[model samples]
Target: MLLKIGLVVIGVVILYVVVQVLLYKRDMKKTKEDLLTFVTKNKKDVSVTIIENDDVVLEWNADQKTPLASTVKLVVLFHFVKAVSSGAIKLEEKVALSDIERFYIDRTDGGAHAYWLEVNDFSEHATLLDVAKGMMQFSSNACTDYLIDRLGLEKINDQMKQAGLTEHDELMPLTPMILWSAYVSDRRRDAFKKMSGVSEEQYKSLMNEIFNIMKNDPEHKKALEEKMKKKNLLGWRIQSLLTQKLTKSTTNQYAHFMKLPG
Candidate 1:
């Protein structure tokens, strides 16, 4: 009777293990199905590329040149790492929060920079590496813009080509988009009008002109911040235009960018 009970106990344990395995597989299948449903629902609005081991494992709108918006920071982040590796930017370098604020506007960026400030009690300054972390971690536009200035826009674009990212558009400063709302000297002061009427090349030139002042002149940078702080200029309407206009790249090239050796 004791021997029979022990065998029954062992059989029960094996049955429990098998049931758990079956449940786990079912859950995994459900998760994949859910993810596919979500992606299919939003595929019209998004570009997605997933790469593994230098292979195009998945892609949607991969060849379409799409505006990167904040994801442009990925290219900038790549350049920052390259600069550090080449001994150009010291990781421990001191950076003033005041200087970063020059590029920051109060309401833009969905409070990313503000959130970074609240959590990091750096007093007056933080290191370059820390700021870079905030760029990726918090999506801080201020940190991104500051690093763009520090890293040099020309060099950033050059490195994009060096990385064989043929689909990339030129890297430029942010915060200038708000200035296009009847506040600037351009003919198409209204953002939507410019989008509707101007050629792609013209719009790009306009952004370049705005960024040049921010790049070369400190006073213009301060002026830009003040204007952007106003933030009441129907800016949300230009979301689609921004993705098409600003520093666009194909999902394909960015997929390749992901495969690069750091």
Candidate 2:
């Protein structure tokens, strides 16, 4: 009788394990199906990665290299946090408003340029955390531009390279009209003057610096190659243009545009 009772207990435990395993697999299948359906319905090229209990359980790339619209803000926030943590930028450090940030605010709020704008009165004060929050929540152009300037484009690009996302691209800040025109037309020469707001001589010098860096960096070269291999022809082309410091249309002409390079 004792032996029979022990066997019954063991069989019941085995059944419970089997039931749990079956339920887990069913849930996973349902999740994948739901994700695929949503992507298809929206006609969006997106990549979904799921982690469960510290393990990656699902990876679906509708279009992995496609430029993420506002999602790139996440990368900007990531870098901001890193910079603060590393003591490269102090959280309490005050960054005075530049012409760029002021311009953005004026245009956004329909304020006049000649009007006096103070830090507390100028619509907003830009702190380290405020910048990060702006990037993450609103994907604010002014906030992103400010952060990029403070952090250095090269530093951000390097962090992206280290993160293993190499296909992301960035352009220098430009005027709204010029930026919009470039986005619409994808013309480099016409927008060059408008975007950089510098003399031709200065622009030429800046281009040379960017070219030297791209020409010398092995990781950048490899990332471009990998992007090409993935059949992201537009992305490959955009990287080439950026390396040459040639202004293109909108930055998102290619598919995914992550703030970090993959």
Identify the leading candidate in terms of TM-score: 1
- The 10-residue segment of model 1 with minimum total lDDT is 1-10
Best prediction by lDDT:
1
C-alpha lDDT of all candidate models, in order:
0.71, 0.45
Q: What's the residue-level lDDT of 187 in candidate 2?
A: 48
What does candidate 2's lDDT look like per residue over 22-72, in tens digits?
535667656768976888886544466555555557666623444444445
How much lDDT does candidate 1 score? Answer: 0.71
In TM-score terms, candidate 2 sits at 0.46
lDDT of 2 at 102: 30
- Model 2 residue-pair collision total: 14
User: CA lDDT of 224 in candidate 2?
Assistant: 37
State the lDDT of candidate 1 residue by residue for 1-262, as single tens digits: 3344335333433543454455357666567779878878987766878988766788888888877877788788778777776778787899988788867766777777887888788899999977876776677887988898899888998998899998787777776555555345333335467565777677667766766655567677666555544454445566555655577788888878777665
Error of model 2, residue 232, in angstroms: 30
Evaluated at residue 114, the lDDT of candidate 1 is 86
